[model samples]
Target: MIKSVLFDLDGTLLPLNQDDFAREYLTHIGAKVAQVIDPKKFVSQLLASTDVMVRNKDKTKTNQQVFLEDFLHKIGVAREILLPVIDEFYETDFVLVKSITRRAAAARQAIMAVIECGLDVVVATNPIFPASAVRQRLAWAGVDDINFKLITSYEQSHFCKPHVEYYLEIAAHLGRLPAECLMVGNDVKEDLAAARIGMTTYLVTDCLLNVKNAVINTDYQGTLQELAQTIAQIIKER
Candidate 1:
């Protein structure tokens, strides 16, 4: 019995080319903070810090904490100096990247179908970004109106995707066993990592991302429309 549904954002619910989105995102955010630090240097250090966050396994610090500590240290700036600027950028300039993302009608359908079944819905996007950025992306995906049981963000999550620990952390947050959760994502490796923890996996083929061309082994695979139909069938069986 699946008690919760976890959906990956970028390539899953939200259709986007990762590289293109990152380029547009960095361009906007870099411009926003150019006054405090050279945009070139800022982008470089920001990425390095993000890489540190991705590899971080420190349970003692949230991903945000790890990112900020390293980013601030490397840039030699106080949090008070850089944080507000970034926050303002997220509030104002972040929407500029939305043009690159198309709203997936099926994405909304799948999430609503899960909610209708009374299953907890979680936006299980990689926790490398701050909540503001994640929330904005969700808004662009057109699924931000409904409440999510948990929205994984750097402020809360300690691990990144493709790491089994990340799935475990989400399970812990939901107070549910991995066996009772269904992970839906487009990444062959990152999203399917949930299967390693005994969670059922659904691979969304639309906007699929298999960078390394790894063998894809998922319990269910199809478009978002098919996923919604699959859930409907499960509900009928129940």
Candidate 2:
């Protein structure tokens, strides 16, 4: 009864080394904003803001607001000053980092298969970055500008990955039960957390991350094409 398919962006839908991706992202953005503030300081402050967003428990404030408040405070600037820089950086500079990332055709095929089955598709990437940044990354994946049912950016999300509450929130937002959703991701801890709350899970192993060395117990696991086949099989059975 999987009515929705949630996909992770970084290593799942887009092939990339997470560490390398982060470094490239920061370097490009820092270089772009260096004229206004110290590049090193800007990077540090942005990271601190991400940490604050991760630890955020307040449901009232979106992760975006929490990040902005902390980021703007640490950098000693108004949102008016910092916001434009970030927006422009994502628009112009973020594209340069795509050189380190490669296309994931399996992911594109899988997404198309899911949509063809008449199931909802959601981009459940970790909400550490803003919508503009997320959109740009999706563009790099070759599926940019396609309308997904939802895209979890820091501006709209309240919780980060590895938290069951985040999955629950997505389920709620989609008006579906966890049992009716399938969570697809490359991270064992973060993506598989959906299973804890009753959703089915798929682990995409092409660029998998298992930092905790935790045992994986998802319903299915494999490359993105295999994942698509699994979903198709499930839908065919239904």
Best by lDDT: 1
The local distance difference test score of model 2 is 0.87
In order of appearance, the predictions have TM-scores of: 0.95, 0.94
Off by over 4 Å in 1: 234-238
> What would the per-residue lDDT of candidate 2 be over residues 1-238, giving only the tens digit for each residue?
8899899999998889989998998889988887788899988988888888888888898888888888887897667877788789877788899999998777788889999988999999999887888888898888886679999998889999888888989999999999999899999988998999999888999899999899989888998878766778865653
Error of 1 at 94 (Å): 0.4
At residue 201, candidate 2 shows an lDDT of 85
How would you encode candidate 1's per-residue C-alpha lDDT over 2-69 as one tens digit per residue?
89889999988899998899999999999999988899999999999999999988888999999988
Mark the 10 consecutive residues where model 1 has the least summed lDDT: 229-238
Clashing pairs in 1: none
